[model samples]
Target: MGAAEHRQSPVGVRGAVAARSVAVHIAVLVDEVAFLLRPRDAGWVIDGTVGMGGHAEQLLEGSRDDVRLLGLDVDPAALAQAAERLRPFGDRVTLARANFRDVRTTAARHGIEHAQSVLLDLGVSSWQLEGSGRGFSFQLDESLDMRLDPSLPETAAGLANRLSESDLARILAEYGEERFARRIARAIVRRRPLGTTSELVAVVRSAVPRAAWPRRLHVATRTFQALRMAVNDEPGALRQALPEAAELLAPGGRLGVIAFHSGEDRIVKQTFRSLDPRRFAAVEPSPLTPGDDEVRENPRARSARLRVLERLP
Candidate 1:
């Protein structure tokens, strides 16, 4: 859990490493979140998407001894990792296996009246994409079951194999904003019953012409991202969690959200704008992104955008 876990200057990571480009990356914006939330000034902190407790651990270590944190996540596997990581902090840290959307009720049940800071790092984590063999990444040829929460009924395979061509296209276009959504959806329907990540990847590759493939992104990247979002209902959950976390903030508390892509960023930006400006101030005119060093060290963080919304008295 030393530098290998993570090491940054402003945020807190360790070791020297070469960053490589990948189809998907975990963009936590740890430095910006740690800086803007001002953990030293916080009493109770909440990490709604506390995947592996990276940010939670950083906040606790950076904060005063009295500061406590409540960490929540939909993924049980992630919660297990977090539990082990945060064990050293004892009762100062609380871990819950729950979705960020239910943060309001979950926080209340935990006897937390309000939080001094709340954080939500949207989309899949490094563990899910790389470690978890649940087929989140194209690199893994595992089953197309991308369920963050085990209890979730549906799987990415279900959507890819069951949804109509048009419906599937809509999800790709809207959720992933892929230009070749229609072609991909059509290819998927024709090759229905795609049981594995490799199968789905092949179908996508066949659908998009080699000439039209993105330079940096994999041919199947958008399709997988869209299917995962549809299966998990990410957009819907995000819409609910933003306001809930915002309202759960104390008078001076700030809610920090790190969106990895444009679609998720749009929701975060629009939702922050919809809040009462008099009551909540989005101090950052534009979202803060990972610095050159952070991106150079961890290329996965290149697309991260951190937006802070502070509750006013």
Candidate 2:
């Protein structure tokens, strides 16, 4: 669909031109992110997961002077959309096709020593979940290719077909936090060579008892999540990126992250707490969640958790 056709809600766009060109990807906790990062005085700002440049554009517009922004994302389509939306900013913004895990190398390649602020919005964008034909959502009947970056060697289909029942169980149990992982894994192994999201959903439904189906969540949700996380090595990438981001921040500069799941939030909490107390302090003792108004407007924002920390002098 064209960008104009994708308008669901108007976000933080300042001009009519940008509002028209940019798709409707409602950035979760935009005000909270801006408050924590406060790039108005920062010379350089980094958006580690600049999905559609919603947050990046807001930061640039909110800034006072020439604040250069470095935006990184693994998906080429997302980068293209971001480029189009942010074209008005001219040379003030730089877009890179890379994962957030490579933040250090990307910064060095761009000759950036340190950044005054960094933002990581870890949740998958609405565009990817709803529009991308790469099978990120169980509601879609697309191929089971959940690689956020198409260039990635592994796909969800490969993981489902190749892994042993026990290994698959471990992935579902650990990554997905599903209680009936073993039964689901066994069912998946028996239904080998599943190529599409519909097939996987069917297998999961058959394995899980009718009474055990969650009230709010789909039975196939955990299985799909585990497979996607395994294919992308999401947790490992986050672990690598956190330390690098902490080290790359200028003194008093802040890093803000928005996580959708518990596993991701746990990692963010632990990593931020592990930083030397003398040099780092949590901006908020507890993670921030979306208010009732935001959740009512965008259901996806309901599970988002925002965390911020600052590097002290």
Candidate 3:
């Protein structure tokens, strides 16, 4: 079991300590999200992927005392930290261990049928990348288990070691958008039973030519991202969640999505554009990105794209 699960209470002292240590994991584009959502006018707010409660805490602080929020996440570790971080809000804050794809039913079960604003920060949190020990980062030497939800049956190790070269290549190419997907898949196939992040990283390094490596990003970044997305079925989850969120939006309600990968952004773009123009409107011609200063402080925010949709009153 993970360290966070061992604690008796998520809002207890130990979880509080863990929350404090991860203060560096900034929630990307907080100001922009707050501006679009307008917490002051909100009655029910749902942060569909409330990692570490950064956005949730800010919304509570910025809104009226009665404005309640229902926070959902697949990551138990993140939810625990969020519970600790949002403890001061008392009963106004309600959290559930759930995937964003299940937002419609989860919200109903919690007695929230519709919300004035919903925010889905689809990027995996910095805490998950740096500290979760879940093999989300290639820089980490942890085991090759990238399942964000422990209940997930497949692991990165299972996909890498078990799949055929053609199948693995397709996953790399489609999910990660890796140019050297076939080469990487071939390398992985030759090196079977890979069990650690380092092992997979080594195989990727050997597959791509030295000169072909990306100058700005790590050689294994895309590979790790693709594996994580595949193991978690991120694309499928996003497709399911976006429509459900739109359905639960009240008139004049705003739904915001933060996407880090091109594939993720594409899905968001298409879904938002496909909404009925008479009822729902794309708030902007394009997605909003982090300001230069925000990106400077957190390099991970460099690729973040936020798209918003609002129901017409």
Top candidate when judged by lDDT against the true structure: 3
Off by over 4 Å in 1: 1-27
lDDT of 2 by residue, 48-157 (tens): 99988889988787775668999999999999999998999999999999999999889989999888888999888878987989999999999999999999998999
TM agreement with the true structure for every prediction: 0.90, 0.91, 0.91
Please say which candidate is ahead in lDDT: 1 or 3: 3
Clash totals, every prediction: 5, 0, 0
- Where does model 3 exceed 4 Å of error? 1-25
| CA lDDT of each prediction against the hidden true structure | 0.82, 0.85, 0.85
Candidate 3 C-alpha error for residue 251, in Å: 0.5
Error of 3 at 89 (Å): 0.7
Residue pair clashes in candidate 1 = 6-13, 7-13, 7-14, 8-12, 8-13
Error of 2 at 207 (Å): 0.7
Model 3's alpha-carbon lDDT is 0.85
Could you tell me which 10 consecutive residues in candidate 1 have the lowest summed lDDT? Answer: 9-18
lDDT of 1 by residue, 126-242 (tens): 779988998999988999998988799989998888889999999999988999999999999999898999999999899999999999888888888888888888889999999
Query: Of models 1 and 2, which has the larger lDDT?
Result: 2
